[model samples]
Target: MSKRDYYEVLGVSRTASDEELKKAYRRCAMKHHPDRNAGDATSEAAFKECKEAYEVLSDASKRRMYDQHGHAAFEHGMGGGAGGGAGYADMGDIFGDMFGNIFGGGGRGPRRGADIGYVMELSLEEAVRGVEKQIEIPTLDECDSCDGSGSADGKLETCGTCNGRGQVRFQRGIFSMQQGCPHCGGRGQTIENPCGKCHGQGRVEDTKSLQVKIPAGVDNGDRIRLTGEGEAGPAGSPPGDLYVEVRVREHEIFQREGDDLHCEVPIRLTQAALGAAIRVPTLGGEVELKIPAETQAGKVFRLRDKGVQSVRSRRPGDLYCRVVMETPVNLTSEQRELLQQLEATFTGEDARRHSPRSSTFMDGVKGFWDRMTSS
Candidate 1:
């Protein structure tokens, strides 16, 4: 019987992408696998057929040859297969060549090192105005003994098991499979005598001191990146970066919102009732604030340009100071007598003129009492 078309056997169109072809082949292979369909010869045969179809159609050069000249391209040693026949061995070699690279095999070259992060705590003052700090970090550095070669005396030899191919192939029932060589660990080369310093790992753990410059106006959770400061990768790979994360500490007296500073200043009751000039603390130093007469408690006073200057802008923020009037306690006997006399003098005057709120409250109380008596 004549063979079926490879694309038809894999159930994919001629224009199928590589990913789509792989998905279709994986689905068909899993569905009709001989291991899954035990005692079913037809399903096992179909599985092998699907594997064969995928082996040819998944390759660009093989698929082109099969499309133009059919299977005859491989009949007379014309194509790159043993005896010019599309056998399982040839198929396994092709699959291994392509999929091995995808799966981190066949000496897939050096990989970049992993990036690391460190949380740096900063005071509110330091965060507002940038500061420089030195920190110590523990990381992996390239071994200096053999120059990261993992070989003593800087000597290496080809793997004997895989003949320097980094992989080994074996025949199964109706298919062939390729796997990484067990002896060489897929490196294709082996150290005759391993380095004593890194123990053949090609990297060592060491602590490094780094100076980090934090920019002003950086808020909490901000990240500063230092290029090529992270751990070194294996042997020939490139080093990674180091990331510094900022965490601002809480202030004792001030609360910051964006670029502004807010604080509460306590004032005596007399300072609120009779005007006075009070001293207020700012980032620049102490400044005098004038409180007007009859100023109520919980009043906010804004001091312009007394807050923080943003890193990105020339204009500075304002400082808001909220006044909290404090009541006197533990009064002396003479002070108590003076307060009593003041209260008596306030009652003798017209209550409406002296205390408008008290006068209005007393009038309401009198009206309620008159209504109750009449009822």
Candidate 2:
């Protein structure tokens, strides 16, 4: 009998991606699996046919040949056999790939340790300027007592269940699923006598102390990866990485926005009316800000190159200082009398000329009252 097209057999299109082909093959093969449809010859034949289709399509070379020439590409035995493509002959390995990532067991060897994340808090000054800090973190470390072997007399026996393979296969419905051996815990060996310190785990809880260098201009939420500094792997495998995430505490003097900094500069009422050069606080230090004559409240003054310079962008930003007029408080009788005398000097059109905003507001109030009475 002539064979059906591989794409048709697996119920997938020729342009299907490798992942799509695998999903299609998995569905078709499992539906017609011999184990599921026992004593059904049609289902068994369908299963074998789908498996053959998957084997050919899964191999890049075989897939290219099959795509160009169709079934006639392999008219005789095969250009390449079971070794070239995981055909129906190797059900063990084929099913292992299909079910591995889904169930977490495959031909790939042991896994490494889990990565760890540590949040490091820093002040605004420390973040802008680089600093080195010594940090201590609690994690699993290789047991010095057992040399990470978990065996007490430096002796281990092959696991009876997995037969030194570290994985065991079991029939799950129509599929054969594999997982790490319970007896060996994926180590392929069992301890004759467990270590007293780590018990048979090959690792123990320990504190790791190291000096970490935080680069300058690192903002909040930035992370620094410390390679191979994470928890020790299970059974002496390669360790993982440690990530240090930076958290910048709020500053009292300045508010940082991207590279620029903003701060409030308070000046006396007399200084706002007349002119005065007042000192303002910055991240670096205090700087002199010249207030122009008759400078209004909330007037912003830009200081060039006075803000933070980020690590990524080397260009420094400007500092914006908003002038806040300070009202005199708790004045003595003489001071109150002097303020009253100053207030008396301004009258009528002269007061209007001095405070245009206040004159515009009174005019608006008059207009509003006129409109209300008319309505």
Candidate 3:
């Protein structure tokens, strides 16, 4: 009988992507595998058909040829065979690509260690000016007893299960796949005398103190990386990196936003009206700020180059000072009489000149009430 279409055999669309094709092939191969359904010739044939279909569809050049000329592209030696693609006949690689992790496929090299993170909280002044801090971290380090060889005697023997190949082959119907040896854990060897210090892990858990220098202008959530400072790898493999995360603590005087700083400065009512020079605190130091005459409460003053210098651009930002006018609380009889006489000068029309904002607000309220009454 004529061969079935590759896409039809895999139950995938003609325009299926490589990932979709692999998934469809995996499903079909698993469902119709003869090992799963022994003594069933129909299922065995279906498995072969799906296997051939996958071999052709998974290859780029063969897939293109099949798309253009169909099965005739491979028939009568138009091509080598259905399994003619590069390493298509390698069942170990094919099945390992599909189910290697689940079945414990063996790997050649030593695995890298896991990374770690540490959070460092700094004050606003420290973050802006840069500071060096010492930190203690609990992590895995290479054991000194066995020199990371995992064997106390520094000797290892070949695995009996896989015979030093690290992988064991198993027959599934007519085909077979290779899996990692369970006896040696895919290391191809076994320790004769395990290390007493690390207990054959090659690394031990220990607390390490490290001095970290924090850069200036590093904001909260910024991370600094230290190479090879994380957990040590198994069997003397490479170590991972350590990440130091920055967190700025809340300040009593100033609030930071990016490179700029903001602070509220309280001034007396007389200072706001009459204008005066006062000392304002900045990241650098205290600076003289002149309050303009007739300045209102909540007015903002900008001091150039008085904020934080950015770590990235190294440019300083402006400091913003919000003024808050303070009202007098306590007064003596003579002081109260002097204030009453001063207030008496600004009455009726003079009140509009002295307190224009209050007069305009009162006028708006009166207009609103009159409109409401008329309506």
Cα TM-score per model:
0.58, 0.69, 0.68
Candidate 2: C-alpha lDDT: 0.78
In model 1, the runs with Cα more than 4 Å from the true position are 1-108, 156-192, 312-315, 344-375
* lDDT-superior candidate, 1 or 3: 3
**Tens digit of per-residue lDDT, candidate 1, span 236-297:** 35788999999999898888887899999999877887889999999888999999998878
- The top-ranked prediction according to TM-score is 2
**Would you list the clashing residue pairs of candidate 2?**
none
| lDDT of the candidates, in the order given | 0.74, 0.78, 0.79
Q: Ranking by lDDT, best first?
A: 3, 2, 1
RMSD of 1: 14.9
Model 3, C-alpha of 65: deviation from truth (Å):
33
- Kindly list the per-residue Cα lDDT of model 3 for residues 275-316, writing each as its tens digit: 999999887778899998999999999998898999999999
Question: Best by lDDT, which number?
Answer: 3
Per-residue lDDT over 1-375 for candidate 2, one digit per residue giving the tens place of the 0 to 100 score: 889999999888899998888679768966986557878999979987886787678755457657977876544212222122333335656787876766565543445665778999999999888899999998878899988887777898987666677665654344555555544556777788978777666777789998999998888889999998998876677788999999999999888888888998888899988899888888788888899899999999999999988789888888999998889899999999999999998997899998999999999999999999999
Model 3 misses residue 236 by how many Å? 1.9
